[model samples]
Target chain A: MRLRNLGFVLLFVAGFAHADTAPFDLSDAEHIKAGHKRFNKTCAAYCHGFQGSGGRAPALNAPDGLPPEQMFTVITEGRRGAEVMPPWGTSFTPEQIWELIAYIQSLRSTAPAAP
Target chain B: MRLLESIRTSLLSLIATASLAATAAAPSIDQAGSADPTNWPQYHRSYNAWRYSPLEQIDKSNVKHLKVAWIHQPGNITHGLQATPIEIDGVLYYISADNNVWAIQADTGTTLWHYVPKLDPIVKEVFYGSASRGVTVGLGKVFLGTLDGRFIALDQKTGKALWSTQLTDQRNEAGALFSSPPQLAGNVLFGGTTGGDQPTIGKIFAVDAETGARLWTFEIPKDDLKSWPGESRKTAGSSAWMPGTYDPVSDTIYIGTSNAAPDYHPYSRLGNNLYSATVLALDPKTGKIKWHRQEVENDSWDFDSAYEALLLKRDGQDLLVHLNKGGFVYVLEKNTGKIQNVWRYAENLNWTDGIDKKTGKLINPVRPEVEKSKLLCPNLLGARSWNHGAYNPKTGLWYTHGMEVCNYITSAPEEPGPKPINALTLGLEEIRLTDPPGKKADGWFGAFDPITGAQKWKIRYDMPGLCSTLTTSTGLVFTGDMRGNLYAYDGDDGKTLWQFNAGSACRGGPISYSVNGKQYIVIPTGLGSHAPGFLAGAFPGIKDLPGGATLIAFTLE
Candidate 1:
């Protein structure tokens, strides 16, 4: 009985933690600005270039990149098995992570036209 | 007739001298203690890993005239070059960022041959990053550990693949990788596996030099928590990521271990977590632990004892010297891991009250509290990261390059999973604490007495000295920074003698060697790795310099 109840609790947590259920506004200008700062300080310089293009890691500003939901999961919980992307949940809150995602999305929108 | 004879005699003497210098010998394993002016054969250029050269061709007075000899830009590897190129017979052998072996002419920056490992889909997907510390050259072959966990041997003369063996499988448990350069001692090659962040248990291996065969393996204790009796510990992270120093006299490999598993939360794994944050004296043949000393017991902060264990001789007594990321320099008996002295090198450190003189263990006062901000000094990146320090036998001083930053570390409750969310948490999410007062500098370069662990002299920098320190018998010391400035200082008094703007962060391995009677100092300028990323968050003054992977060689003009 106890084991079954614990399983239910985990299921409930997982349900609410879905990427679709992510809170806050990705379209917010202030939120995106805040994320840009965080991303540049933590992620941009190491894996991605400071401009969010790419160096050691893949380019983050691709027009048709992963949805914000998948990005949320990858950012929070590092991809297991192929452990390239480390989990940043402990380092940044969900709100801050969403801000970073928004900044990355903005980069895609502002990307220069390919000649 | 007399004038013609004299001219011939002088010319003959000059010709003989040139021949003798050209045929100079490569450094042997037995000659590690004594300084070699010509060759940089080993990782630390010696078995002791002192990183000190007896060559004084470019001394303090003449270092001002040092100029760029040549610059070799490795094509494929883009982000930082970490390999300390080993020189032999006017040929330097080193591995690039992507596991590509390059045999370049030491005199001219001409690439003789390049060997790139063709990886399968599985290896490609799993092999994450590119940053090899260096390669070991001996037994007529150049040896290196691949990022995909493979031990490979290549022909030194021709970049031909001789033997290859898989060291560790990442699929086992989480995964394991090899970034540390393999140390070749006698007939066996010693190497350590990295992946403490992967949360896998750490291990050290001894491989046969002749054939790529596993000789012996030593696993750090999984549950060394003496306080927690009868509890079987599943995972204890103690990765030996850095290349260890070899002591020929003691016949032991001195290597330091990384932090314990579930890093931030010490509540899960209690006790000293013996051998995790400890240095071990292991027999190279059988990989048996002879003696071990735990520096930090129940390490709340991510203080790994994983730095270069330099073997130094003081007053005719052999001693093993190590600088902990936790901000302490320990002097121990080379034969035994008995602590002779321990001293703090960081200017302001509050992670612990201090190390107990009697126990040789840290007086750890701070414990991981759930959701509570615990400000600690000599932050997570460590007072000193894995950047190699140099020991000058002439001055009896050890030069270390490191940071002096602090952090507010807070850990969450333990959770069960492969990569637990709350295992080890960087307290960046917590409320921002004010920087320590008068912290005009975030980095420091220090020279300390290896015998008494006393600070002889030090210099502060706005940015941390990230590159390994290299010293020469000519009373000149060399180190580099994140701002891409390579500096030459007076070894005794720590005075800046000369500087160079390499146009990028020079944080990789810096080594010196002589080819064709010319002394040259080589430094790799590029930026990549975890420390710089941490600095980006902690210090706002830190610059995001452009990416590079160029090896710049310097000599007196």
Candidate 2:
């Protein structure tokens, strides 16, 4: 009977640990999906091309992909080139920035395998 | 009886004569005072544009305890206020957006008089924007240049118009409109800004101060047929949007010119466009060019040379220092157009390899596939825009805010299909992220070692856009950001001493003055072309910021 009680207790403890780790567990699939949604909504195909290719904007899916922090700074702070890019920090949240990063990461892997 | 009557009549006549003399000797306006520390006269304290005030009441020890004295919210919602108020006696005189001039009590900040010029029926159709940086005072009259290209003189006491004259005939494309205050020497010196993409010519005029008469005009692109007697007549459009500085001792006026028209394409207008991107030294009396140095030759990047040319004397030698839009700080001998030194204040600028020492020519080669997609540093708007910079003789340091960014430009074979429908279409495209991001490979403030052409110190900021700097005798450098925070830094070192949230981006320069033995610093805060686009996203918490104008003054308690 004691042995049976120990098995039941272990199961209860395992369930609690799984629930606690759920919020922190960002699956790769989920991250890429969230990022794709953000890129389509905010940027659209107008500047960044239909598949993160180079056009009026630059190609983001390169070998030396943008660092996560740098990507966040560009979106939040905006780029200063020949003209000025409107900043996104006011319109978007910190979580949204991370989502955009995930989308950029997805583009890197989706690109043709390097030589 | 007859003798006594005659004597009484003579005595009455003598008393009447004495009263008339006393009235004539006193100034017409009681608001006029001479040699008073409480008044700010002329554009930069005096006609010399020194920007130095003798008031030392607000020293470094007491500046920390400064508080707002009186805030005059003009509530003028047309555009930004770029004018520095000129105080005479105890009354302050200034011009605002939409070309409205105002006179206020310096001590109380109460409006005394306001004058609005009657616009011509055709002026409404002009593409000129509404903004008047400031005005000049001399010979008991205040002088101002209008957006529609008219110069007006007004009575100092009452805001009544004395005389107004059309300075530019825009219909013929001779000149467009004035965006800066008219500088006054023995005469009034002023220039104009042109309509974008228009084939307009820019010229500087020296008009008689007392009588509205044109004395002499200096055309930016000299008529080769007239001046040189040979060469073809070249078209040069250099909009002089900022005010020029004058040197009375030499009787010379230093005027800087803007970029050539159809700015993106250099092929449309050939030849080394003479005065388009140059600083010209002219004789104020004759309007003849004494010497000139083209800062940028065949400038394809819309980099204007039209910033303020500050005249200073270093090492007992008269010198002129100007910040060009192409990211270079040029030091030239004021008397002779000799290039003494040149240095890049903004890093990551790949426009030019370097300036040639012997010829003083900027070796800016056309990039490969330039008409295609070519990445260039210090984009067309320039490292620094129209905002003015300040110099402190005591510290021997020059303070200026600059942009450190590159652009990927694809010049079309012909002009673009059509101008962008609105301001949003004129937005910038993001390039590959720069390496070592935190150093503001985008925008920040830099202090230059004037003598050595070395950057003494630099402080990086988040975004890049228009801003101005002001230096004080108290060893403090004051400047603002597009994020609406005004900052005070040490003059010798770029250290942040204090900061105040101005609630709006500051596009105008700040000035310091004194009243009743109290020192005060005044700055204008509002929306204008100088505001950065990223500000809306960077400071989202303050996004719904209303746009208006106000002059805020601070004094030590």
Candidate 3:
């Protein structure tokens, strides 16, 4: 089952416990490369700027800006209302979204980008 | 024997004349756009691709007295309201964001029936946000193309499901959906598949309008092996995403096609990608290409030719006036796809050095190269957005919006991933919006001659007008801006006669129709799309713009 931050009333209907989030290995260059490729191919074209420098959407250039759990949840359960952002969970697996999140984190890190 | 031959020829000529007279007199009742002023029937309102209404009840003399008669709200407005509404007799029909259809009374804001489709969860993955350009109302049925690869028909009266046909294969990770309403020609219904920038093959198809059975499919990219070289053709992003109109005179359908896949990278797929960034005249019954004109070769700037192909007749010749996303407008001979005149609507274009006037060939294009970012004006959105332009027959001018913005683009060789990823397939290292050099970044609306491209008058807006433009026989034009201001302008001189705050930015096509002897002008208000993101670089205040869905109907008080 999936839960979304749709409304305050929906929260009263379902209560569940959360667990410690497993972080995506941002140090892995290959993983960050895959995420960068995905971001360049998809997000950069329309929503975000090139290399997450910021355009229409927020800039993901700062790795410490967002918590892992919050980022994971946001990607998993997308913001209910957005101009263009969609729930990645519908299209990607949890691990794949982490692959995406890790790449976003590497944008502000010392990890080298792919060719 | 010579006398007999001459007699036979004379008889044949007489019969041909009678047949031509009959065809001209017969009303095309089954046609989606029947050229009726009482109803806004099709996307272009009529097959001639003119969004002009003949109703002059509220002319320029009294347009200032226009007042909102009523407003209808279509809930679940995620991408806001972008689809053009259709009306017939006293009934109005429109589709909201999740493919929901609504039937409302034209005179009043009473909801007759509302339908919500059971869509696939994959609908959430549509890169352009599952937007149906609009719905088609004909033959007692309303037709809609959905994001989950289905084309459906609903009973016009009760809004009940009449028949459903799955068009696109949902299993493909590349994700192809229908963004335009199915256009009707005879007993056949045809529409183009969207997701033009995805790693999927694009096709336009014809289906039995009644039974919902597939009739014919024409691949937009031609033969994969012919235009595209090697495996690169596998993901050639060519689609006729926008609605194309039918030309009753030539018995042909005119539609513009989208750009090739991996839009910015010309290094991978060399040669002029046939049919990508092209305009095709098709036989609606068979989906056969009658003639085609490729507007751009190996389109490297993400510019597509898939906008409305407006049809007009001038100088004793039939012509098709098309505005390519690259900003150049091509005037083509109607019978054959020969270029007559090529002009431009964009004020700031640098992707090409110039256009050859005599041969109509693009001259010295500045192609985007790998690792090097070049400033290209009219980025993916082109000179104009998907919101259509209006051609007024009475005023003899074509009205459209033009953007004065550019983008810095670095080309990258992008390939389809091992699996269908969650995003688009653009071959770009980076793309960011920028102001056009030496001038302020602004959008302007203008009136021009369809054949000669002569400007009549123009009005500049702080930001681009994102909604469709509509003209009336009253010599007035209707358009809306991102700031939620709807203006009524003089169609001849481009003078603002009246203005109203629609409460939210208008996105859908503005249309005028009459019900029970009263004419009403309807405009959809809401704004949410990647367009605002593109404007943020030029118009910083755009981020705080209000967004909501409401259809405002206005009539002279």
Candidate number achieving the greatest TM-score relative to the actual structure? 3
TM-score, chain B, model 2, is 0.84
TM-score of the A chain in model 3: 0.67
**Chain B TM-score, all predictions listed:** 0.90, 0.84, 0.93
What shift in Å separates residue B521 of candidate 2 from its native position after superposition?
0.9
- Runs in model 2 deviating more than 4 A are A1-115, B1-39, B46-50, B121-125, B172-175, B195-197, B224-235, B367-371, B413-441, B530-546
Pick by lDDT: 2 or 3, better one: 3
DockQ for every model comes to 0.08, 0.02, 0.36
What are the fnat scores of the candidates, in the order listed? 0.02, 0.00, 0.54
- What pairs collide in candidate 1? B237-B261
lDDT of 1 at B315: 68
Query: Tens-digit lDDT track for model 1 on A1-115?
Result: 5985586456434533755755777778998888875664343434454446553355676676788988887777554321145555544556767888888888888877656
Model 2: per-residue Cα lDDT over B1-557, one tens digit each: 33543454355335334423343332211111112334566565543344555566765666667677777766564555667777765577777776888888676678999888886533433434466788887667888888667888899888899888787865455336776778875555555555322445567777888777878776676554432122222234566677787655566678888776545555555556777788888877787889998887766666778777766666777677778888788888878979888877767677788787567787856532323666666755577767766666667677778776555554432323322111111112222222222343456787776545577788877655355666676778777876677887877777877778877767776777665555677777765543332222222222344445777788776
Model 1 segments more than 4 A misplaced:
A1-115, B1-33, B120-128, B222-232, B420-434, B437-441
Q: Could you list the iRMS of every candidate?
A: 8.5, 13.2, 2.9
| Candidate 1 chain B least-lDDT 10 residues | B420-429
